[model samples]
Target: MAILIYTQNYDGKFKKSVFELVTYGAAVAKELGTEVTAVTTGKLDTETLKELGKYGAEKIITITNEELNDFSAQAYAYAIEQVAKKINADLIIFGNNPYGRAIAPRLSVKLNAGLAAGVTALPSSVSPFTVKKRVFSGKAFADVVIKSETKIITLNQNSYKVEENPVDISTEEFTAEIPEGAYAVKPIETVKSSGKMSVTDAEILVSGGRGLKGPENWGMIEEMAEILGAGTSCSRPVSDLDWRPHEEHVGQTGKVVAPNLYIAIGISGAIQHLAGVNGSKVMVVINTDPEAPFFEAADYGIIGDAFEVVPKLNEAFKKFKAEN
Candidate 1:
C-alpha cells in the first residue's frame, strides 16, 4: 500500500540483499498498515523471481530493458523514478551496494525525496517516519525522519537475518516503456573479479595484510582459506601493491563485509579497515605483535607469528572437526 523495494538482480539471480531487503520492507509495511511491492530491474530468472513471494512482497513488478543490462546510473534512476511514480509508492528501499549507492541518490534528486544512506536498523515508528542508521563509521547512530511525501533508503548489508518462507507468491510484469534520456556517462570497460564469493558476500573470509611479510607468503593465506572453504581478502595496502585482487580488499574505500566468521592473519587493524569489518559476527585476529591494533577489536586474539601459528590453527581446526 505504501512501500516499494528496488531489487538488483545480479546476473539475473537475486542476491542475499534481495531476500533481506524484501523481508525488512515487508515488516515495515506490516507495521505501517501497508503492503510492500518489490520492483526488479533487468533480466531475471523466472524460478528465482517466484521465490521472492515468500519474503512477503505482496506483488512483484519487473522491468526488462536491455538499456539496463549494464548499470547505467542515469537509466536506472530514470526507470525507478518512473516505476515509483506509476505506483505512487511513498517509501522506497535499496541495498547499500555500489550500484545502490549510485542510483538511490539520483532517484532521490529526480523524485525530490529524502534519502538516508547506510541504514543499519529498521525504522522505528514514531508518528512521523524515522530510521536508525550508522554514523561516523559505526561509532555512532542517528535516527532520521523524512517528512517528504517520498522517502528513499539504502539498507546496510548483512544487518538483518534472512527470513525464509515457503508459500506461493504472485508476479506481475511491468511494461513501463523507457523514455529517451541524455546519455551523460559512457560505458567503460567492465573489469570483473575472477572469483565467485567476494569478502563481502563470503560466508567465511580469510584475510591478510602487511603481516604476511611479502606477497610470496600469500600462498599460505590462499591454502588455508581454500582448505576452510572461505574467501580471501586483505587490508587496503595489500590491494594497493596488487598482492590481492581489488575486489577482495576490505575496509573503507573498499568493500564492507559482515561474514559469519572473519579470520585476520598477520594484519594490523586500522580504524578505516575495522570500520568496514566491524559488522562481522565473529573475528579472530592472528598476529605476532601483541599490540597489533586488530586484537583490541577481535572476538579472539592470538599473539604469535602467523607463519607458525596459522598452520597449527588449521591442523587443530581439522582435527576437532574430524573428532566431533
Candidate 2:
C-alpha cells in the first residue's frame, strides 16, 4: 500500500500549500515504509506535473476529463476515491483548505476510512495511527487515534514546513466515469478576482479593524499592504459596517488564514477573530488599547494610535527595503 496525496491545483498550477502537502505526505510515507503518490485533476503539461517529484511524489496521476475541470466536491471526491482504490492507498493526505474540507469527509465515507481533519503534525505513532489536531477552535489540542484499516488526514496550513526530497517520478492519466448526479449542483458562472493577492495564498497580510475609523481611511491599510507586498484583510466589525468587503474579513465567521506574518492594525482581538488567525507564524498587533485581547496572542504588540504608528512603520519598511 502507498500514501496518496491530493495535490489540488488552481488553473493548472500548483501552490505552496500543495508542495507542503506533498512534503508532509512524503514524511508520512517514509514513516510507514511506503512510496507516496500525488493525484490531481485538470489538464497540465508534463513539466508542471513533474514538480510534485521534487517533494517525493514517486508517481503522479492526473484525471483529465474535460467535465472535471469545474470543481464539484462530490465529483472530485469520487475521482480521488477511484484513484485510492486503484493504488490501494492505505493513507490519504490533503491540505486542510477549502477543497480538502469539502472532499476529505466524503472520500472517507466512500472508502470506509477514518478521517482526521485539521491535523497539525505527522502521526506520533504509526502503529496505532495517532495524530494531533487543534481543538476548541484553536484553543487546545487533541490526539486522535484512527483504528480503521484505511486512514485519511487533512494537514492544517503552515503546520508543516515544505521539504524537498527528489525522486524519479512517473505520470499517468485516469478517466473517471462520473455519474450524472455528480453535476446536480453545477456552477453556471465563475467570476475571477484580479489585481489583488488572495488572502488565503498570501504569506504576509496587513489587516485593519474598526479602529481605522472608516472606509475612507482604508487607503493607509492598502498602502501598507502594497509596500509590503502583502494581502489586505479586516476584522468582522469592519466588514459588518461595510468599511471593507466581507471577503477580506478574517475571523471564525470569515475565511481562515495562516500566513507567515499577520499585521493587525487597529483591530481589537476577539476570540472569534483569534481563532482564525492564531495559526499565523508571527502575529503583530497594533492598537491604542493596551488591554486589547489581541496583544496577548501577538508575537509583537504596539500600544499606539494606528494613524501615527502605521505611517512611521510604512516609512521604516520603505527605508529597509530601499537599503537592502
Clashes in each model (backbone N, CA, C under 3 Å)? 1, 0
Residues 208-245 of candidate 2: C-alpha lDDT, one tens digit per residue? 99999999998888888988889999999999999887
Q: Compared with the true structure, what per-residue lDDT tens digits does model 1 show for residues 173-194?
A: 7665556673567778877768
Q: Report the poorest 10 consecutive residues by lDDT, candidate 2.
A: 190-199
Q: Which pairs clash (backbone N, Cα, C closer than 3 Å) in model 2?
A: none
- TM-score per candidate, in order? 0.93, 0.97
Q: Candidate 1, which ten residues in sequence have the lowest lDDT sum?
A: 175-184
Taking all chains together, the TM-score of candidate 1 against the true structure is 0.93
Clashing pairs in 1: 1-35
Question: Which runs of model 1 end up more than 4 angstroms from their true locations?
Answer: 43-45, 320-324
Q: Mind sharing the TM-score for model 2?
A: 0.97
